[model samples]
Structure formats: structure tokens, C-alpha cells
Target chain A: MNVMYFAWVRERIGVPQETVETEAATVNDLIAELKTREDRYAAAFADISALRVALDQELSDFDAPLAGVREVAFFPPMTGG
Target chain B: MQVRVQSEPFDAGAELNGFAQGRTDIGAVVSFTGVVRDTDGTLQEMLIEHYPGMTTSAITKIVEEAVSRWTLADALVIHRHGPLKPGEPIMMVATAAAHRAAAFAAADFLMDYLKSRAPFWKKEITDQGADWVAAKDEDEDALNRW
Candidate 1:
């Protein structure tokens, strides 16, 4: 699976993207797994409410099942236009 | 419909002139262009970041909705990313319809969705420092009008 970050989340995580092999079933579970890897991931995932998630490039919920998901993205609320 | 996500600056006037050109079926065309604001005059540059694949797809969905609801003949959306200076055009939305109301309403609707739905983030680089532009609550609320 490919995991991605953007904006301040990317800055906090210190990387834009990575390939992860996980047994997680949901977006939240993936975050929990990444949080245990380093302090940076922990800091980035500290405030889940301040973040938004996208599964396979579409906006999705953190509790969304990741059964066939290939990509996951996390970022702050968009400030486009 | 046409959607472009690029870092290159575009001439909004030229784009508007070319949109829905030579189309006898279209009677009205409306456009809105967003420009970078240097409110305090301390800004150095505005850096825009976007999710490459999602940005285009999200905006395309918004345009599709606008077209379906408004009876539009054509629509165009162009958004810029990367570093930009104050007063530079950030994005533009144009819609063509058989009537003025449809054209106007669709353009407005596109702006509203693009403000909060598209996966783009902006960072303001000022003389003092850099800060991410937070999404306003009103932007999210704007979608409720639809």
C-alpha cells in the first residue's frame, strides 16, 4: 500500500509518501501502526480531528474499510481557490 | 468541459474569449478569477500544494455537477500551483449557458466547491515568516446552498 501526506502533515511527517506493508483493516488502524514507528508519525497523527483522509484519491472517512485500497492520503482541510 | 491543473500562469482574458466561441447555442458566459491577496503588504509569495491525481479528479466532479444542474453549454476551470506572487491569478472559472442565470449560478457554484473540496493547500510566505492558510468555516458552509 502507498501512504501519502500533504501540507503541514507532510512537513510534520518529514516525508511526502512511502510504501507500507500493513495488516490494518481501516485508516485509523493504519495510523495507529505508523504512530508506533516514530515520533514524527505520532506527532502527525496526534490530532486526527484536524486531518482529512482520502482512500484511493477520493475523500473518505477514517473508519472506512481498507479492504482493496491501494493508496491513502492524509492532509489538513483544503484551502483551495 | 475543460479542467486544467498547472503551475504555469495563464491569461484569463484570452481563455475567456476563447471559451464557448462560435457557439450559437450559448447566449451567456460568466467568469470569475481568484487573485492572490497581499493584505498586509508583507507577503513574499504564496506557495500552493496539491494532491496531483486527486486535484484534477475532484474538480472534474464539481464541474460535472455544475453542468448537470445548470444546463451549461460549456465550462472551464484552471488552477495554478507552486509559488506565486501577490496579485497573480490563482485560478479561474468560466461557464457558458443559454441564459444569464445559469451561467452566473454555475460559475458561483464552481468557486464554492473549489474553495473547500479540491485538495489544494496554500502557504503564505510573508516577511515575518510562513504560515498555512486555514480553511474557513464559511467555506464549508457554502456548499450547503446547493
Candidate 2:
């Protein structure tokens, strides 16, 4: 699966997107898996409250199932307009 | 309905003039243009980032919802990304309807949704540094009013 990060999360993670292989069932589970990889991932995933998730380009909750999701995105709350 | 997510600047006036033009059915056309506002004098530019694949789809979905909710003859949304100077246009929403009230309401509805619900992110660049603009609770609250 492809995991994308945007805005400050991208800055914090030091990358825009990456490919990861995981058995995680939900968005939160994926975040938890990534958190154990490195300090940067841990720091970025430390506070999930400040982030928003999108599953396959649609806004989704942290606990959303990722059964068939090809891509997942994490970012701060949108400040568009 | 039309939704455009581009990196280049757009002419709001020309867009409004062309949208639903010469349509006798549409009597009222309401437009709202959002400009890059610099809160302090030290601001240099505003950088907008968006999900390429999701931006158009999300905007189109919003426009479709507006069309279904109102008696809209037509609707248009143009949002620009990349770096934009102060006072430059960021986005514009236009709605056309048989009466002023419907047009006005639909335009307002689109603006509110675009403000917080859209996938775009805004970063303010100033002499100090660049920082991502945080979403405000009021912006989220504004959506609930409709």
C-alpha cells in the first residue's frame, strides 16, 4: 500500500509518500505499525488527534477498515478556500 | 457544474461572465472570490497544496451536492494551488439560479464547504518563515449552520 503525507505531516515525516507492506487492518493499526519503525514516524504519529486520514482519497476515520484500500493519506485538517 | 483545480492563476471576471451565459433561465448569478489575505505586513506569499487525484473529485462532489440541494441552473468552482502572492485570487465559487436567494444560498454553501471540507492546504510564507495555516473551529462551525 501507498501511504501519503501532506503539509506539516509531510514536513515532519520528511517525505511525501512511501510504500509499505503491512498486515494492519485499520488506519490506526497502520499508524501504529509505522510508529515503531523510526523516531520520525513515532514523532509524526505521536499525536493522532492533530491529524486527519483519507482512505483511497476519501475522508475517513482513524479506525476505518483498510481491507481494499490501495492508498492512505494523513494530513492536518484542511485549511482551503 | 464545473470544478477546476489548477496551479495557475485564473480570471474570475471572465469565468463569471462565461458561466451559464446567455441562459434566459438563470436570472441570478452570485460569485464569491477568495483572495490571499496577509494578516501582517511581513507576509510574502501563500502556498497552497492539494491532493491531485482527490481535489477535483471532492470539488465535483460538492458541486453536485449543491446542485441537488438547490434549483441551480449552473455552478462553477475554480481553486488555484502552488505559490500565490498576497491579494492574488485563491478560489471563486459561482452559482446561478432563477432567483437571487437560491443563487446566494448555494454560493454561500459552496464557499463554506470549500473552506474546510476541501483537500487543499494553505501555508503562509512571511519574512519570519513559512507555516501551515491551522484549521479554525469557526470554519468547521460555519458548515453546520447550513
Candidate 3:
């Protein structure tokens, strides 16, 4: 699966994009897997409270299932304007 | 018809006029322009940075979502990404609809979503140093109030 980050989320995560192979079934499960990666990933996932998740470009909740999803994006609440 | 994430400043009047070109069905056009403000009660420059492709795609999604929820005839969003002086145009959103209500609502919704949901990050250059503008709780609350 491909994961993307934006804004300050990308700054903290160090990389803009990454490909991960996981057995996670839900967005929450994916976060759990990411948190186990390293300190940076843990710090990024440490505060999911301020984060928003989008599955395949559509906004979704953290608990949303990721089954069959090809992409997952995590970022801070948007600040575009 | 156009969505841009660029470093150069844009003219809202020209852009809006261009968007409304040759369209008689658009009875009402609503637009919102965001400008750079001098934060910290001091006159300082603002630097806006964004991921090029990601920023454009994210803003396009927000505009599309607004169109999905409103009866808009046309829409345009142009956001500038780079260093900007105070009072310079930072972003612009224009929406056209047969009725003023739909145009106004859709334009406002697009701005609200863009402010809270876009990939652009701002850094305030102050006398002290450059500091990335942290996401504010009030900004998020503004979205939740919708």
C-alpha cells in the first residue's frame, strides 16, 4: 500500500511518501503498525488527535476499514486558505 | 475551470472576470480573497510553502466537494504559495450559481474547507526568527461549527 503525508505532517515524518506492506485491516490498525516503525513514526502517530485520515482521497474516520484500499493519507487538519 | 498553486501573486478581479467569461447563466458570482496579514502585532513578511502536486490536488478535492454539495454553475480557486508581503493576495475562491444563495454558500464553504484542509504551510518571518505557524484550535473549531 502507498501512504502519503502533507504539510507539517510530511516535515515531521521526514519523507513525503512511502510504500508499506502491512496486514492491517483498518486505518487504526495501520497507525498501530506505523507507530512501531521508529521514533519519528511514533512521534508522528503519537498525536493522531490533531490528525485527519483519508482513504483513497475521500475523507474518512480513523476507525474506517482499509480493506482493499490502495492509498492512505494522514495529515493535520487542513489550513489551505 | 482552473486551480493553481503557484508562487506568483494573482489578481482576483482578473481571475474572477476570466472565470465568468461568456457565461450568461451565471446570475450570481461570489468570491473570497485571503491576504497576507502582519501577525504578532508587528509588520512582518509571511512565507507560504506547499507541496506542489499535493497542494493542488488537495485544494481541487475541496472545491469538488463544495460543488457536490451546492448548485454551482462554475468555480475557481487560485492559491499563492511563496513569500508574500502584507496585504498581498494569498488565495482567491470564486463561485457562480444561478441564485446568490448557492453561490455565496459554496464560495464560503470552499474557503472554510481550504483554510482548514489545504496542504499549504505558512512561516512567519519575525525579528526573532522564522517560525512555522502552528495549526490553531480555533481554525479546526471553525470547521466543526459547519
Give lDDT tens digits, candidate 3, residues B14-63.
89778878988878989899988876666478888765546777888878
Summarize candidate 1's per-residue lDDT along B1-146 as a digit string, tens digits: 99999999999999999999999998899999999999999999999999997999999999999999998999999999999999999999999999999999999999999999999999999999999999999999999999
Rank the candidate models, highest lDDT first: 1, 2, 3
CA RMSD, predictions in order:
0.7, 0.8, 3.0
Off by over 4 Å in 3: B41-70, B136-138, B141-146
Reference-based lDDT, residue A62, model 1: 94
**Model 2 agreement with the true structure over B1-146: per-residue lDDT tens digits:** 89899989999999988999889987899999999988788889999999997899989999999998997999999999999999999999999999999999999999999988899999989999989899999999999988
Give lDDT for model 1: 0.97
Task: Give stretches of model 1 more than 4 Å off.
Answer: none
DockQ of 3: 0.48
Worst 10 residues of 3 chain B by lDDT: B48-57
The lDDT values for all models are 0.97, 0.93, 0.82
Any residue pairs clashing in model 2, and if so which? none
